[model samples]
Target: MHTSAANELKSESLELLREYYQFPSAELRNRLVQLNLGLVRKEAHHWVNQCTESYEDLLQVGCMGLIRAIERFDIAKGHAFSSFAIPYIRGEIQHYLRDKGSPVRIPRRWQTLQHQATMLTRQLQVQLNRQPTDQEIAAALEISVAEWQEIKLAFRNRAPLSLDAPMHEDDDSSASLADLVPDNRYQSFQLAQEDRIRLQQALVQLEKRTREVLEFVFLYDLTQKETAERLGISAVTVSRRVKSGLKLLKKIMVGSSS
Candidate 1:
């Protein structure tokens, strides 16, 4: 399907669902039941090997979750339907795993360490406006820096692998995560070069007076009044010119993007 048509259909479906949910008529409820069942079936299909339960059994369990979500949904809370549905869906899936006694548990020590690390990182970021360093994380987690290092080392090769994350193909058609990470060193060098080129281009685009005003205000870190005095213009005129020049530059940049 064309992207536009698909988007339209999705929008229409959501609108219809919202209307049905609000009214809660028999017909609307039936439609919701069918949709919930279909969603369960679709999710079950993806977990055939991982799940010992039959698809029908999984579907029934998932429907219980779907009903709970529907009953608890509050339009006044201003959350999307999918956001509210996720917890219900995950709960159902987890219950299935627990019932089957899946042997995929993380080590208890690792789980404790992971929880502590995560909480510490979040707290540090809230306080410092940046991610915590290893030393800071260790202090927050009440562990020695060496112990923290050891814990990190243990999990270094055990990172959760996201199947959907992008990978790069080699010339011989092999893929790797190395290609997905931004080449920060190379990108920084390119960015510096690009900024220099853009500044030169902007200067060329501006009138001499405007360029001089910008140079004094930016490069020399002069106040608008100082820049205005240097250019023999009022501060207001200097401000207006700077604003106009910025708008022009923004247009140029946006145009380049397109």
Candidate 2:
């Protein structure tokens, strides 16, 4: 609420932070967090321009940064907490913005490679006096040609997108990229064969009527009424069959799992 300025109490606050390490109390930790809100505000101001999120949201993220910094700070390191905590605070905000800003959730491995390859390319270009070749880039980055190609794809997907209305007020275009692009859902790389086997075993145990209901309701994605009409049964009968089938199916699966 009314914290002493971080600058004014640098030494005193550092001591308070070390005290936090000893006692490990949330009240003290929160008090330290309040005192260090200035750091969060300062870092939030710096990132406000680069990020598309509202300044208020950025500040909230920055406060998360501050809290993390407080949690991880070590008094035994003998460095100023400001110097130590700045990276954690900045990193927290950057990480939050990175996730918030990206339309695609790029895998962590690729994210690391993106940084590595970008940094490597810049260094190689300067060192070699030209743009690096795929061979040269791969060699320096210690990745094979196929891996390098996948890295290239990841770099493309990781590019930033703006949430602002796609078409400008003056534009007459009917379709934006959102209209043009198809959303891709993530697919598991492999089916669990054992699980599939277990499911089949479970399905085999269902009664003929119940299995038929399940097949129509799920495999064909038919409504209960439609399934009933197709099966020459009342909708209530179809509903009962489906309910009983799922219950039996769950029992079989649970037994199999155990």
- Which residue runs does candidate 2 get wrong by more than 4 Å? 1-7, 102-258
Task: Give a tens-digit lDDT track for model 1, residues 129-149.
Answer: 554677998887788898787
| RMSD list, candidates in order | 22.9, 22.1
TM-score of each: 0.35, 0.38
Worst 10 residues of 2 by lDDT: 161-170
Instruction: List ranges where model 1 is wrong by over 4 Å.
Output: 1-9, 36-38, 100-258
Q: 200 in model 1: Cα distance from truth in Å?
A: 49
Question: What's the lDDT for all of these models?
Answer: 0.56, 0.61
- Which residue pairs clash within candidate 2? none
- Give the clash count for model 2: 0
Query: Between which residue pairs do clashes occur in model 1?
Result: none
Model 2, 138-228: lDDT tens digits are 8877879777876665454233322112222213323222221222431231213333334444555576778777755654445576577
Give residue 17's error in model 2 in angstroms.
0.9
